[model samples]
Target chain A: MTVHRPQPPEDPDLPERPGPAGTPPRIPEPLSEPLSEPLSRADEAPWRRVHPVSPLIRGWIGLLAVAWFWGQNWFEDIILAVEDPGGRGAPPMEGIPFLGGVAWLLLVGGAVLVLVGLSFFLSWRFTKYQVTDQHVNVNSGVVFRRQRQARIDRVQAIDIVQPLLARIFGLAELKFEVADAGQTAMSLAFLRLGEAKRLRNLILARAAGLRSAPEGTGAPGPGLPGTGFSGTGAAAPGSGVGPSEPAAGAVPATDPAASPDSAASLDPAEAPERVVAAVPVGRLAGSLVCRPLTVATVVLVIGALVLQPVLTEDVSPLVVLPFLLGAAGALWKGFSSGFNFQAAASPDGLRMGYGLLDTRHQTVPPGRVQAVQIRRPLLWRPFGWYRVAVNVAGYGPGGDGGEERSTVLPVGTFADVLGVLSVVLPDPGTARPLELITAGIDGSGDAEGFRTTPRRARGLAPLAWRRQGFALTDTALFARTGVLGRALVIVPHERTQGIALEQGPLARRFGVCDVRLATTAGPVSPRVVQADVEVARVLFLEQADRAARARHRHDRDHWLEENPHG
Target chain B: MPQEPVDPQGIAWTRVSPKYAAVRMAGWAVGTAVTLLVLSVPLVLRLAGIWTWPPLWLAWAVPLAVLALDLVRLSLIPRQVRAIGYAERSEDLLVRRGLLFQRVLVVPYGRMQYVDVAAGPVARALGLCEVRLHTAAADATIEIPGLPAAEGARLRENLTARGQARLAGL
Candidate 1:
């Protein structure tokens, strides 16, 4: 067995490819036989163009603009001609010699069509993509040529998006999200759905540093030296697989033959995936009904109806039109994006599929999740529904078009939430994980060892004084806050970017402070608000040491060999 | 006066140069002069008999109020500068700032993405530079302003070295 250190590219012109001669065995073989056929042969014939109809599909927007302008002008010209039958008013194109109005229209329309077609052709000619074992590169742009290349290992998530237009043509788009926030590093748009899936699998497998194909017959061997029995194992008590003695019952062995779905005809090159949670349409609709925005919208509409008779006739319906449209639009966006949400656990990481018209399949790799927040809206408490979001390093800041791609579970039962949590973190760093999580969610006031906000905090947070607190385990910190809309944010000690203790003048008078744990730029922001100043200071100092120690313990970059499931 | 949160940490915090207060006062003076110059236009117009829409007292009142407020703020420069201090620990760097809303941030060296040494024209003339430590988190940008140029360079180098030594992936 040999260990391969990730070697930096030696030259600017030529990056060091992983699968060349004399390289380590683990990284090379999987590249050759990716998917059904030899993808290496396809890779050798590099710079493959996207689907031929890609330009036409993308050019529809431009086509629509042109058609709109032409239609508007054409209608005005015909109407003007009708109003003045004897050509008393000269047409706009009258300066041109000998051409009738219909002839001029045809000529100009043909010219516009030619220009649009030429530009589309040039765009199609210039745009090209290449996938090497080391990098995924895309070269595009007609005027200002741009070349984007993201390292295969740096890919944080891969999304397969099939918009209604593209889906009609049996095509999909591959979006590569790197560790940089809010930017798709590279996109190969309009590929055959099957090809896109295969390409995504190839990239994920290579990223995981797998020796065998992703869906090979054998289970992943104990490849890394210090994986299952590392000294840090004791710290991850929730994982249940103890370091000194592995618990067989807690972890289902990765035996494909033993699994019931082994008989299903799965793609040979894809990993055996198990669906962890699926939100039904009925539940999804119910969850949406309770949202604060939806409720407010409903109230506004009802109030408008109730006051209709008493209100003055001078009040126009258009006055309230904009607000109604805005609110309803927001609700529709939430509903569509979360239409058929499904979360699956695979060797690569957590795979989620959602969206109504434009279906999206996003795969967030293991170990990339910085923090997780399980939130229960006030109305959702009765149904026992919780929404889970995370702080992934790359997917932030309008990455989901103001619709949070960070949400791993949009709406799920408590059991479903735990299942997703178990897969994402694997180890909650506590012996009694269920009780601790339950306390963090439903219980308050020092339950399950949580340090609740002191009585002095009543002045600062009157309603949430009892619940605004924090709890710590060996591997992670749990900060719970809010009374009406409860939130429990869990930040793994290793992932904590910084710890801060903040105190305002009012809080200073009350001898209270807030402790904040900064993670990546996403939805989950861990903060213990309105705590005793003395306790906050101690926790702040202690948290720094804990984070440093946690970082020291968990250093493995190649997560595939760890066998998180087993 | 409120207690400083850094008291319990027992870490020796390095204070910025005293000249920073002078720099800040000078900046405030320039800003106030420009503001007063722009604001006195209405007063000049009212007094010159060219325009009397705004009452003469009202025009005069605005600039006087701005000057008075600026004077009070300018006096607190030294104390605000004193409140801003940074401490370098074995595993992390701690930055504390703000007089009324005191905040102390402890950023682990391993979490640092990069170190930036920036000097504005005013600070550059005064031979001072600011050091900024950027992490993956957007909110974790730790800025330690008003250091001597040489000290700032040294801190940047030290932080960059430490970050590389204990570098962890996002």
Candidate 2:
């Protein structure tokens, strides 16, 4: 069989159709096709615009400022010590000739100046980005210059993030996710709100054009481009169906000349339409308070306060309370900030916007999603809510290895939960609500079409001591068990990597074994399913075999039919 | 010319190198000793005037406990090694390992991402290297430690080339 190859575009200008009203018009295609041609040379030109150094660099700047302040204090102290030795503790050592005070100021001043200067220089050196007709290019480095470019077609998701300060200034940062390779992502830092939106529209248009392009095109494939911004728009032209489909709708049809103004208005409204669900404030508050990290932080702060007087002897017990209170306030503030979380479905995939103070927007496309996980904490049972997250490739800061993408839904009610899940998994809303299964497990027998396995039933007693596993009727995802301290793991069959049947010497003698399902995120141990060794072995093997087969088939289709660009 | 069967032990049996078991024992011994030595240093320093109390003494207890745990663990390592063995056939690589828990990880040549040959300082001193078979899954990495450096490098090259050939077929 001949390998499919995209035909190269002969004229670069052919792809550069001016968008409505001087805005770059989207290429006329679904936003899922791969680009056939290399990005126009104009797209890669340097000197378009550059980003300030990442906020991480500001930390260095702050450090340098502190050092300068400290140096100044030290200099004054030295002057006093030298000039008045017996006056305080020891007179300033200024009598040590010209080398004492003068030398100190010069040394300290020079060091501080150098540090401040380097911060600015490094920021300038490390932040550079370019927007062109076909792609967004970013080149960053202090010591080793690395270049990353995202073709409009390959752009799977776009995100716009505005820090509180940035929001006040109407400035935002943009991120473009290309594909599976983490290194290929392009980021645009600190653009004016208008400029960022314009850039987003242009990139989205390009992505749509590339998506609609015929297969074997050299362009990047269609998916949600990873945009780090809080908002993303996944707009693609209807695939090959012609304009007739969209034109048949409720909105009035406009001539091509009138389309620009209409499109602009339509574009802004698209953001709201894409939203699947908004996270409830109450549920988010509960989840945050329930987090082990939050609990540990509180415990540590309280312990520090209580022990400070005994340990230090000099520090007052009252001093500890303020510090503890301050820490608690900060935690509460951070949690509250992300309370009104919003998840929206974009043309490319999904965009989740959260956080109150340092608002974060993460964009994930359907294709980049490796797996989905739904977790319900034991305490959350009464509320009928679950936490959902996806395992996507690429490791970012505050991520768990290469597994972290973004939490699509930190905490949401059942309908809101299903709304987000449908974007990631197949047929999510059709599944039964969680309450029925819980009631069934409680022996109310209200659950329909759900039966607990003998192993699961026996396992329930031990599991209830920690947490009981329940099933969502009509969904393949299983809730095996929950513990008070552990996150309630919901493992969908498709995402399970392998199953391990573990038996210790004690357990082996008792004829009970634990079955652990492994995923890319981490190992999820579902406690002793109360089965004989032989049965356990068979179950483990069966699950593992199914997982392996499913993964194989999925990968084959993905590599072959799905990602035509790669 | 006729091709010979690859197994040295013939049908119904497989012979794994005794060196594999020896190397595992050595690793456990060195690991335990180093852990004990590291843990004891803090206690010694605390007895001196160099530092103050709450010197993470509880954290230090973890490694001390680990050292004691390794004694039991060392005894279990052999059975684990015996249960685990690697066999290379024309089509795939089969890795069977586990003790009370057993697993056989099979990787078709086509699915391999890369083969990494690495050695820690201690393993290098023992003239051994580790070969890690990697796939796309971030966490699904399998390592065969304590191979001779030459064999490790050779295996890496062979697997890499074969993996490339298979990828090209796709």
Candidate 3:
């Protein structure tokens, strides 16, 4: 592949240059030429080596595993029939007297071996990946060829995974998650380490270039200047290239009077430059290593180890050794896999790269982000940081035939969380500026600037244990009460669907009621917030009115557009 | 300060038929009876096996007790019906119902996506129907039970038309 060196313009303000003055400007090279020519078929287009895992074979193996465990009783019954041919201490076998004993063992053993062998062979053959200038492509499958391609622009995030065995073999798997088109998000997996990193950088550069470019192109321009838009050849040093300048419908003007700093920041090369300096390896590892799933897995393993001997009478205690060993190996693998997690602010959005055996890389673009959530668990309080996740449309499965969506950052520190949030949210700084509204135990008086609703105030001192309520920095949304646990939710005015006012027999006697403001994100089920029935009625009406007004201003269609990077 | 009771009109009532109260009461009765009958089956068989006279009477008495409980519950249907009501205006739809406690839910017609009107055999015989107002909220669904059939249909039509108009304006 040919590499292009960008030419620097002659400017007195620029620092001394190391390269020769008269050399021709080099155009950055594309990763690989598209297979536009008919002659370049699969064979000629650089034979991609892949490890195959056929879908049919994978299904069969999964079936075999299930049958082995679930049909253990059937297997045991067959053994009993052979041991006691005359049906002594055995349930009567009603059919198929001939070849019953030998057939059973052959069927079970044959099925198990076939499934395991096929799986291993397929895993070895079909998994091959190629990273190109525009997209990352993965080809896998033995019987049914499955090929998945994710454009650099649409790739939201990349994850690297290195299984213990794969790490031993010096191999890593790269997972490229693209924004979902419908219920499925495109993914590319399994690439060599060096190739994966190089490809990751190429995709990151393209994503960043797309972000910095005028929004209409959607396609990422080459890293070199003058390649972004047609007829706008390389501008001289210091040409004003404000985004609005392109909107004025003026022909490209070559002027050498714009600020260099602004122009430099827009450059595609500058995309990697900014990210390279701030890649938070430690923060990324901290985010991925201590996820809830990891904790749950560890707890399950410990429980299984403790119960193994007690649960099985016939099996000797030695059988538990393999189970313990496997659990320990898996735990160690999980830890090592996330140890190298790294997240960087790339031009397109944010790029999270990590893995132990198979490296997974992800790139998220800003346009694909639907919403941002910042959560602070009690255990994470001492860290003075919050975990951040983005709600993106068509990104994950919604459990009952609904669209699939997923969070961008499953975990991250406050600064890292804020950094990613700024790119995805319209106003990144809004969370920091807002004061948190907390629900009190009673309807009594509150801290300065906070007040309890009238319903809660009625039994203030006496029934304080049951009532809790508060509004935020602004009274736009309120968390009134939670009987079991406190929950704070932001009910956007536009997103509010309705209001519910509930009064129990006891509450009615006390002239107190609870009101809930519902939103599209989820139902706001606040309990025990006290207010008079009349006040509750009025609050419901007011909230509904605000919701209607807000809904009017929302543009649902904007979220439907396909994001090039997730 | 003590607050005066808010007018019932101010509270939102579900757009449902009075027959829903009857159906709910019937369902509760059936559920209770079935539960008691299931619990008595083994006892009856065991009683028949040993000490037949007094045990058989006790076994027979269990189902009778369940039937009596169901009858008492059925008697509360009218009061339950009185507690349920539906109110619809140009801007919003309200559904209110409760036994011992009252709940008033308000769903703005503009935010409503659709309204579903349905009736089971018993409700149809009683000339009543149930209406459910669907919104974008993931979990919040406003259901009004036991409305006269004609009123339920009219409310559904109005809600649908208003929702369409609001959505079009957007």
Candidate 4:
């Protein structure tokens, strides 16, 4: 006879303890230090040791993350529990003298969960992070040690992530995104929420090549203990590192690691970072619930529940349907990722992070953001809400989290959109970004120094000919196209990887070609569709010149600079 | 700008050696005849045994469609070959191909990852080759086919030199 079993989503293959952190994930190993490399970083140097509580935040996400790779066996039990309200029945202990098979299995399952949690805890305890002036090193693994070093100078972006449970405990994970495509972003998980913020600031400072002095050591000072940014923690006013602004009021203890000994340290008092744009909690909540995807999901869920008993099949739609339909994941992901969205500009680039469940802190320095796009869906017109996304070099391993990779604005007003876009493309290649954008998109085509597809090409791009076109300025290329829904992609010449012009039978017959400007960052495809062939040729040649010039003009050794804005 | 017809002839088109077209046509003719024979076998047998009305029509339809497609392919060979050409500029390689789409791609020498020339058995028999240019971006590869083997090699060498001189840094 078969025994009944309740399972938690567990992948059979996911190493509860990944044997080698750098393996399957396949993060590119750091290049070996040169033979003539300079002095090694001091072991006692401040910024060498990670905050004490690194394990809690990372392990929390790791446990939840396992549900994905795990066989999803736990899902069936959730459905079974809800499907059958049958009260707990006595186990078949009557047959087997002491205990029933079900009881034993339940005990085993509980024990496994406890064991998994303990392992995550142990893993967190063992993991160590060191941020030197030149590199950020992550070391972990109980039996087999793995150390990952990302050069601070080469850091593409830094993301601080907090999963739902970790957020409750005021913890987060810092991810280092680098320039190498084959290399995986190095993750430093589960630091105290306050400590994560301080660490992010310090790393950015070093990445900017600001090697004035080392900040502080790993241990927290006596005056500022328990500064994890938890609401429960009593944060001393004016605590730890920063320009004195409490990080969204989540300032944990001043980074005990920032500068305990040096009089010149821990105070970025001169480090000028001011909040450029922040979405209100109310607005963020409104955006989540009112999103087109969310509303459709709610409707579908309600329908599924209402149709549950009437369904012909024995399987419940509640649990099974979400697996069958992708929208459910989209709904949860859309709402959870951008909650409490905030964007700030420091001497570096723009720092944006948000998540009710998994908080992500990503910094795109001045020269790295390849492209910026501001889109207003037709449905959003009346509400005056626009969504914005940017593309930065080295935002790796997001597979298809296109929107997640560069979401500067989840939902914001027109003014808010301008505020964010201004940060992304401060020098939007135009003297007047406002007028240029308005004319290009509104189809109010009274030529504000922009052009539309030639009339002959109307046959090729029937619906969008009037609106689709590209404009070249000295610094950037702007392309706008849409029939019902519209998009405007701005790519600075310096950031363009390559540009392509495509034509097919139909396009040739219609005497037009499509020009695509490829950038190394973001998912936006900047294409000028159905342009006159001659026009495309000229644009192609012009773009090559513009790109070469743009590269030299903005040749920045460091991504971060002192002040950013038009 | 004045309107100009999207014509491949306007550019000083580099014609692929006619011998290549002949070899391609012969290969296509044999492939088409084999596919038609395979498809018509059941119809031929069924008609021979049962003398069925449907099989009679089906038999002719297979050959007819095959004939039509083969003839179209034969007629388009020159145009397809003629449509492909590459122009090496001072700083970039300009590749033009396609009869219908009139596609043109300008790959900067700086972005060139590598240049490759492939000659298949049929192409080698006809002394023809295809030059492929690759950039870091995957989809940005430009392949120009049906060039004389000598010309393909020359283009490859030229592009390689330009790429080395202009390769961009990370």
* Candidate achieving the largest TM-score: 1
What TM-score is obtained for chain B in each of the predicted models? 0.91, 0.63, 0.72, 0.80
lDDT of 3 by residue, A1-566 (tens): 21222322223422211111123322121123321122212223232432222222224456556556636756676677677666453444445452574476568756765665556556544555544545556666677877766665555545444444334433344555543422344333333343344344445545444333332223222121111222122111112210111222121222134344322222223233122112244544454345554566556667766887688777555654665576557555544444344444444454444444443444555444433444555444454444444443333435311211243343444344434443443231123322232222112245423335564445543544333554433214544443332233334444456777777677767676777665434112333266666666666777666666655555232221333223
What local lDDT does model 2 show for residue A444? 17
> Which CAPRI quality tier does the interface of model 2 achieve?
incorrect
TM-score of each: 0.85, 0.62, 0.54, 0.69
Model 3, B1-170: lDDT tens per residue? 11224333344434344447778876786798678879677577766685444566677777788778777867877776776666666577666666666666677777676678988877788888778887755445788777788887887787778888786211
Docking class of 3: acceptable
What lDDT tens digits, residue by residue, belong to model 4 across residues A204-310?
Answer: 66666555423332112111111111221211222221123354323235433433333223222223444555666566666666667767777777888889889
Model 2 residue A322 CA deviation (Å) reads 7.6
Q: Which one wins on lDDT?
A: 1
How accurate locally is residue A54 in candidate 3, as Cα lDDT from 0 to 100? 23
Please give the lDDT score at residue A383 for candidate 1: 95
Question: Per-residue CA lDDT of candidate 2, range B59-163, in tens?
Answer: 478667887798889888766665655656554454545655544444556546678888777667677777888754444455666577777788788888877
Candidate 2 per-residue lDDT, tens place, A229-257, comes to 22223222223211111211122222234
How much is the lDDT of residue A386 in candidate 1? Answer: 96
On the 0 to 100 scale, the lDDT of residue A476 in model 2 is 39
Query: Which 10 successive residues of model 4 chain A have the least lDDT summed?
Result: A218-227
lDDT, model 1, position A290: 88
